[model samples]
Target: MKKKINPSREWYVLYVKSRHERKIEALLKENNIETFLPLVKTVREWSDRKKIIESPLFPSYLFVKIDFRKESEKVLAIRGFCFFVRFGTEFAKIQEHEINSIKLLMEIDASMEVENNHIQPQVGELRKIEIGALGGLGCEIIKVNNENKIIVRIDSINQNILATIPSSYLTQLATV
Candidate 1:
């Protein structure tokens, strides 16, 4: 018999315990639940030398593709699983384009850096990258650090991740 795919299933983002993303992912997979955990390769320092490590792109966050009408409880029961990301009282179902954009961001070369600055800037226009790797995704230009570095904000999981894009790669989008 072939496994049935439920059309009602939707992708939802779940908040997990800090640094336990991989563990929760493993547990969910072991239980046969579909999960997507985006990771980024970063270099870490130690007394001996530098070592490259794979870190969660959005720390403490993971996505699950499941039929929310039935499988949400199963997801909540998993260890380290917290509440679903919500915008008011209802669960926020992630769109396919958002997931695709994240995959695109992850596949791009080491040019992208995770933005850690919590300060939200009040300036800059929303623009789409039209040139290279980040092409076609909508982003907000936060600041122009110099001629070569322009700080840009990319949205993920109802939050923004900042990356410094080379000036030539950005094209200003006219806001109407």
Candidate 2:
């Protein structure tokens, strides 16, 4: 049996056209719809010079907070607005805590890279940070370039955030 979702405002992911994330975000906000487009600054280099640019962390995707039954059609009608991300027939809903996690990540300004969720076989066990900035955040240890890295998977968006962390801050979680 399918589980019933709460009929209140919840976070949903929307897939938009390539490189149009910011524009769509503006349009959605103009319509009074709450949206979150997480962006990160990166330095881009060219033959002439280097310039810093802000780009969406999750390219081609953004999160919208809405009551799906009432506001979905309004969202869908906007220009460059695409359909909501889905798992089977149901919309993929993001938990409030997950959104807060992303917000915290942005606030910390950690050096990290986003990877597509085509994760390889686990090399190490699941662990959580015991101290420091990301304390209490659960992550899996993965071996990359002969070094261990902490990978946090955001399942709703099919992305993994890999950050360089010292082993001393890690505490193994008890397996059920």
Index of the highest-TM-score prediction:
2
Per-residue alpha-carbon lDDT of model 1 for 27-134, expressed as tens digits?
Answer: 999988888898999999999999999999889888999988798888888867777988788787777666766787788873654343433333476666776555
The CA root-mean-square deviation of candidate 1, after full C-alpha superposition on the true structure, stands at 5.9
Residue pairs that clash (backbone atoms under 3 angstroms), model 2: none
TM-score of each: 0.77, 0.81
Q: What is the C-alpha lDDT of each candidate?
A: 0.73, 0.79
**Every model's Cα RMSD, please?**
5.9, 7.5
- Give the Cα error of residue 41 in candidate 1, in Å: 1.2
The deviation in Å at residue 77 for candidate 1 is: 1.9
Count of backbone clashes for each model? 0, 0
